[model samples]
Target: MISLEKDAGLWIVTIDRQDKANSLTPQMLEQLCEIAESAREAQALILTGAGRVFSAGADLEAARAGLATSPLWERLSGAIARLPGLTVAALNGTAAGGALGMVLACDLRLAVPEAKLFYPVMKLGFLPQPSDPVRLTALIGPARAKMILMAGQKIPVEEAQLWGLIDRLAPPDSLLAEARALCADTLGASPAHAAAIKAMIR
Candidate 1:
């Protein structure tokens, strides 16, 4: 369940499975990876969830059925991370579990004031994908990463922003508008320069 819309030089991608908290299935991940691969032609890309929840993470039912794995999550998130242009995660709501990987992969993250973020791998008795921990540590450092991944703590929007996990907070009603504005601000830079700087730092 994914919706892609092109607006000028921007591509907005939304997860459309609100009935399941927008939890991602293998097919959904594949689609997302495909979009990420093709988004290089756009000036920027924005990823968000349709209804309330941004993403509840991997589909547990599918995982239980042996239909999902860390590799699939890695493939999807890695694609997003490798995107040449600016990529933003517009967190309309909370993000949890493997969904955090997607949020972390984005070049910038903008969350609604009500958004919360967490990873419950330890609480769920599951080992987080190796890349997940590495990315988390790179963004917010080892201590904060430990609190989030090892302790299963819920990070509210304010703390997440202070910790550098979220770059800004927008009101729920204006989240997408804010994300677009942020993307517009980055348009002055040539895509080649931006991609080069991003690759060097990341």
Candidate 2:
């Protein structure tokens, strides 16, 4: 489902469903939320997926099987949004649908050069969660958010960076290094001060 590796002050969380491009299941989401709740003491947090994907998005089969409103699902999405730690998404590959939503929730996002970003919730005949659209618009502006969500447009990493969806870009091979640098910078700040600044921003 998900793997957690704590390296000194940093906590690394990886989605490990490589067979399905690391698609998120309700149970996996629950585990993630639980792990994140217990990781408040960490200096920084990094999220990435196994194999080549950051995530393919929500598990559609599970959703159709009535898992969408489960407590695990809610906790997964809501907890990430409220995480007190400095969070970063290391987008190692493509991100779509709920995967894009997850990236938007993070405090910062770094994408590999070949990665792609898009939301297909509309094409799937579903509306994205309110917070997803709100956060996307906040980061990239209403117009850009509308263009992506309404049009189901897949933005390349370079374009996503230009539009402000991604904060940094790196070669696929150096993506981890870039993510590490960003995490190091974030962890340099006092956790208490970081929390205060985040609270003030909200």
Report the CA-based lDDT of candidate 2 relative to the real structure.
Answer: 0.80
Show model 2 residue runs off by greater than 4 Å: 68-74
Q: Estimate each model's TM-score.
A: 0.93, 0.90
Clashing pairs in model 1, backbone N/Cα/C closer than 3 A? none
User: Which residue pairs collide, candidate 2?
Assistant: none
* lDDT per residue as tens, model 2, 1-202: 7988888778988898999988878778767778877777787788887778898877879867755434554455566667776788999899887767667878889988888898876777777766788888888898999888898899998999998889998777877777778778558888887778777877
**lDDT of candidate 2 at residue 60, scale 0 to 100:** 77
Q: Candidate 1: lDDT over CA atoms?
A: 0.87
Worst 10 residues of 1 by lDDT: 63-72
Candidates in order have lDDT scores of 0.87, 0.80
